[model samples]
Target: MKRTRALLIAPVAVTLLAVTACSGGATDGAASGGDKAALVIAQGGLGDQSYNDLANAGFESALDATGISGNTIESDDVVGQGEQLLRRAGQSGVNLVVDLEYSHNEIIGSVAQDFPDTDWVIVNAEAEGDNVASVLFQEQEGSYLAGALAALQTSNTDDPRINEDKVIGVIGGTAGVGIDKFLVGFIQGAKDVDPDVEVLTAYSNDFGDPAKGQQLAQSMFEKGADIVYSVAGGTGAGVIQAAEEANHYAIGVDDDQDGQAPGTVLTSVLKRTDLAVETLVQDFADGAFPGGETVSFGLKEDAVGLTDFEYTKDAIPQSTLDTLDELRQGIIDGDITVWNVVTDGYPDFYSGS
Candidate 1:
């Protein structure tokens, strides 16, 4: 997630009663004086055009359709303020709270216990509470498609833009279980498409540093990598820049970044944060909220996909596009099973372990 540089309000105390009421089952309706709700944006907030933006889009749509007025609260210091902000939302008489913070799962779980009457929604991570609904995206599935696309584009010498080297690369924010979930899927997809395809991998170790991202990408480019995919958050901006300067293709993550640099960005692995948020909010408004459940969205759900190769479409050959479409359909039809590094260990084909 991309963190925004915005000013935020100080945390305030919340009453326990307010929290309890919000987490409970829905009241009678407008006649019952049920409280409207609010969405607590993750640390990244808005303008990220990625996770936060998707969540906000859904929040707005849901509110407009349900006639449920709501506000989006942002916090620069979300880690220490999870309980405080959540409690405050409850105190404000908000019936439902949509939380986008990845690190606040445990905190939300803790606070949900006290506010059993209020419904809560958290994304990307799971929290245990009857009143809390967790949303997780199948990022690896989309990444697999991106890897397949990169593999196809890397070796097409007929295209002047493509280099002779059949090498692709990935820059992750860190070497953690979460980031590796993307890496493992990407590598598996590449090899699945072309068993001999070369995959160069590295981790920037910092999600916030664009400079490191640039340097890492530059190094990969020098090593004959013709295309690179970035799973690093803001650091990915640097990867896009490196591809532009080196005249190589760069794949973006989470959002549609193809327009970030016309012709330079091949595509983006889009995780639809917007859909998840909208569904949860609508459910709350309809009094059908599924508390204590983790809602999982994957390629099958249209929650993850590759962005239209807007600028690069003309550059990509028709045959390559056909191949991509085939792979996409395969994944959707259950013919292709992408790896989930977090749940499943690295496959024997990739790890050779």
Candidate 2:
């Protein structure tokens, strides 16, 4: 069975209790023993239109579906106060705590042991505890598709957005395996299609800084890259803005940002954090919590993939779409393997500090 725990594991750490709903009365089919839950938003917080927001949407949906009373915690110092936040939630009778901060991986294990009655979830990294459930996504797989798509579009001079240079770019929020998982996959996918394709890489080092994201992306655009992929959370907003202003193409991550800039955004690499949270809530409510194992979501589970080119579908040639479908199926069938930085460490094409 898939891993389950009373807790819903999510990425990023949160500090403050931002949104709270009344615990007045449970609606029908509410979690009998786990009525109260807490979702710890990541460092980037909401309005990211990317990672955090995507998770939040799932969280809200689950709450309504399960009729569970819940609140979301957000903090500027999510990393430093992750433990405190987890403890506070557990003490407050929060039966389930889903932490979206990757930085809380180590601290959550001890926190879970202390609050044995409370279930905990951590995303991106695993924590040891029978009550803790770890959730991971094969981000690399979806990234490969995004990379491949960008590769095909980069040199399509027929499209006004496509420049003659066979160059593309990817911007990461930070330099680590968690974020690098997306970058390396994109690089590999791009190279697989056109070994001669040039992939530029940069790090904004901040998940919430749009200015920094825009700056780095602009620099890449100046360097002959027409399509840029942003894995920088809220900071990616800046990257998208830069792409629009520069009339280049930007691939969004974690969320469907195709509408953010109708034609400017080539596509978005979606990480279905919403589905993960929803599954966790339902599992906890149904008394089917799988506490000691890791629950993973990938392309097969529809956890990660590219947007349907909602806005740019017409711009993408039918052959390119067909190729993307084949590549996606190849990974699902195990015919193609996308390098996983979390399990395999770094690859030869890129290194992190």
Candidate 3:
């Protein structure tokens, strides 16, 4: 399903509050005589090698460059420990806190109210507070490109590598708002590129279960889906296995998963969490934090993109690669705006068209 894009309005009151409240001296010793900044990892924890690892990469890069004394606190119960951890950071005199938890938006908002002096950064969700910075990525844009590529690859009868059925697939971890956002964009992108293309989508209902992911991908493959895109996190590892076993293609997410299965894994939709975290920390260190405001990053900002076809580049036709590049540039140039199913409703250009 394609979603419509809405015009976003800046919250003037929130901006004013951030400016007024964030006027205190630097809490970290970089400016004053204090310690370095601190960061906290969300529920999934670091070794997920997808979301958590990407964010940690940014944290590490920022710390290395700024010489900031920072540590990443990870817990199995991120949502449950949101308030407790946030309060602890505030009490520890930590200057800034960057959280990668998606479900802790409201909790962070409430906690930020109590510690108005501490700078906070949250990803994938929004939180309104005088010292909070919300970081959101343009995932739909990258997914759209992936969808377009899958659509083109599914066809092409002349290519022996092409599938007999013009069908591709998507395996989502859940049917929630976040996962749906990626699905909607993918379907829209496929349709935009080829109206007759068929997208077979399914949900594993669990992000941690790789067996379920493998089973689901197998089913999609049997149903004539030769290419499958996985937004299923750890479970997606199974998707890669299934694709390899079935001699199909699997799309990885968050990180560069192309190397996971050599030529079997097609590519990955990278959500540059590393870049986002590094930039936010740098801004905080420079005392230019855009607190109480949301920083939206998308194709225009090069914050999200498809990974290089490291293992499968030679196998894919040059024509398809050329088209993919054209579509990416079109999106960056504003000639094409991928529908954001999470923020916008179904777009008119896509619905029933």
Candidate 4:
């Protein structure tokens, strides 16, 4: 039974999908003479249309491309059950485990010690153990470009969505170094373009609540913010919906969400989780997994950036588009440095909270 299958597990049910391209099975383990992988879905799970789903897409692609057996593990309570799920995967002889949940960072080092033969990859945060690889993304870099573009577009009266006020906004899922990594960069970029630009900020405190997202964004809109960037995961869908309803603009995160609501979404800050997962899986299959190393993906690696503005290209001014390109190149060339909240702490411009 050499089938490439994905087992999506939830609290009450498990869904399985099968394909015939792979030559391995997850239960066979790494010592079974074939490579097998599993992706532990983060809190919001697969339908996020954002971070979790993006990583899963990469996982599936990698399995197909490398002919490795793989499975996707999900849960209704992923945050609370992360450790248990991970241990089960290791016990089942899963060769590689890519944990997408950020909360699992602190516990992964301990778990990796228990499964020395199972290679591990954790996102956003680093952990100990020689078998673990940490994948980090320079989210602030792409966010800087998003902020600059939003600042430029805020007062452009030509675009009907733009208001006369030089105001924009950002909604984060939570107030922490992880989420602020995007917020601080956006503030810096917007202020660099226009010091007086009023960049409103708020935290939804929940990544899976669209109503909360929409409420916060709508309030910002009422306060004259025509553009709002969503740093929340699944909640970002509500932000886009608010934009469309208010005839304003919303900037998406993690995935290419421009097409999600067509013209309503100005652009999306791509975190490139898909590429990261795919690359890691391929490396594992080739016995080149960068175990004991922290791999960074940023603008230089084409792992993070703004989407191509597919639906809103005609709506954006050429000068504004050109500015984004220049800023992008400047960051890549080290001529411009986007502040990293994850490492640099809160700046005076914006308190992370």
Candidate 5:
């Protein structure tokens, strides 16, 4: 856990092959103490207390429990430095590599070929290689449930937080497919409940700027939006804060953030990046790494879903929870189909994206 960082190398954009299991490992016989791994932090960096932090938690857990040694590499310029870092890990003989940055997906594929012995994990998107395992979360599936809950509560006058308006909103950190996945599913679920519900959407354009997120969320709240779902990583923290200050609702993503502002944060769209990291490390140690396959974590895997709402469960009636359970089952059984921007394309409402 306390080791010197590998020396920095001048980064190059040279073409490389898809990485993973190219040969053996930096240390073979992982259970026998030859296992070690590396985790690449995403663009927003760690301490956002959301995606990057969760991924690091998993990597740290694997290091502690598996008796394997590893290091977490953080970079302000992840895209510019990603290639060099991957190559560095391979050359250092690190047995496994896990990359959390979405922008690094293609780079991982191109670089994996150079390190046949290293097993690599790429999150949020797919990459192909004999030794590469792609981890993707079904974010849309979780967002749909969040939308359903928000829409139900938006029009209720019983709770102080509830307003007279049937309007809900969502703010994304970016306008790309990644965040759109959450927005589309959310809109679909809201429409499923109340076809006339007015749903507003916007982009923060930055994941780590809480001030900007707060400003955007406050604007939505002032416009009669009673609840908002934030897919804006660290930026979403401000959105939650805005909900707290305005006595509205903000649903969290990637982690259990209901406790962030107590009653203000309705629930979090759970995406288990930690479980993915821990499992992949274990699989590599056991020599069962499924390289070249995109493994998706969805409702069936319990990887992407809504939280138990421990803080606000009493506010949500049994009927609402029962409906959610029915929807959940229908989704798992194919009876209820949630819109996925990644797979199904953008919906009619957001055709401009």
Candidate 6:
């Protein structure tokens, strides 16, 4: 979940070669007016493909369409050096600075005040400033559906991947509010569907440590877990890898990672960071940037949801899919309200996120 939302971006063990230029902005143009923006990438950097890469893709898409001049600044120590980067971007005459680093949420308030003219965007968390906007996703809604599907599949004896165990599991990147948002929703979804179901939860402190993710997931599998959902960033990759090796099912997060390991992955919780960035740029272009406000991307906004089970749809029963569709519609229609960890606070399951 290096998705700035994870807010706990650990260093991924990968190399990123971002295209650069003299202005420290991404190539393709010179620094201009409102078209000029800065994206400060969160931890795990650009090659993460999940969080940073998705956000960058949206920025690039905006640039392609609007001719916006911008660059993504990657930092190894996003929490430590993010303020300095934000200040530099503001000083460089960038009209809008969208920070993909969650650690910069509180810092944005102070920084925005220093440069009242420059508007700011903070993802996954909230901050108060006349020039700052917060971007939040309904991860809980999508995760709830994932939990429901896992529960249905786990209870199905007809599915080869499932057994008689009414048990499932989730591996979180870290025990933070961001990670718990996914876990709490999943747990709620499972309990609501099947009260007797048990969800085993664990935390892989390092988002980039796939080995730890694999080890934790293997332990869950040994203890009767048929489907294991992972909220870890790069670490989730390890969980998926373990599922493939064990011939069990794994749930992916952030992107449509169902195809990553074909049928091994059940589904991915869509964060829609791509859409968030694209909309932010579009709003800026339309002179409607919601500065000093917060924008939420939920099921209603189509900002978060599940995939169409592209690679694994055939593996799922039609009845289960129909139930899932009902649950999704319920959420959209407000008949089923998924908890928001950031807004509604943590539930009893999470204790205190």
User: Candidate 1 residues 104-165, lDDT tens each?
Assistant: 88889988888888899988788899999999888888998888888888878877667888
> lDDT order of candidates, best first?
4, 2, 5, 6, 1, 3
Q: Give model 3's TM-score versus the native structure.
A: 0.86
* RMSD in Å for all candidates: 5.7, 5.2, 10.0, 4.0, 4.6, 5.4
- Please give, for residues 117-161, the per-residue lDDT of candidate 5 as tens digits: 788999988888888999888888888888888888776678889
| Per-residue lDDT of candidate 6, residues 190-280 (tens digit) | 8889888989999988767789999999999999999999987778888998999988899998877888899999999888999999898
**Candidate 1 has which clashing residue pairs, if any?**
19-115, 22-117, 22-118, 23-116, 23-117, 23-118, 24-116, 24-117, 24-118
TM-score of 5: 0.91
Q: What's the TM-score of each model vs. the native?
A: 0.85, 0.93, 0.86, 0.91, 0.91, 0.89
- Model 3: worst 10 consecutive residues (lDDT sum): 14-23
Off by over 4 Å in 2: 1-19, 22-28
Clashes of each: 9, 12, 3, 1, 14, 2
Off by over 4 Å in 5: 1-30
RMSD of 6: 5.4
Candidate 3 lDDT, tens digit per residue, 133-158? 99999888899989998898888655
Candidate 5: 10-residue stretch with minimal lDDT: 16-25
Of the candidates shown, which would achieve the greatest TM-score relative to the real structure?
Answer: 2
Shift of residue 140 alpha carbon in model 4, Å = 0.4
Worst 10 residues of 6 by lDDT: 1-10
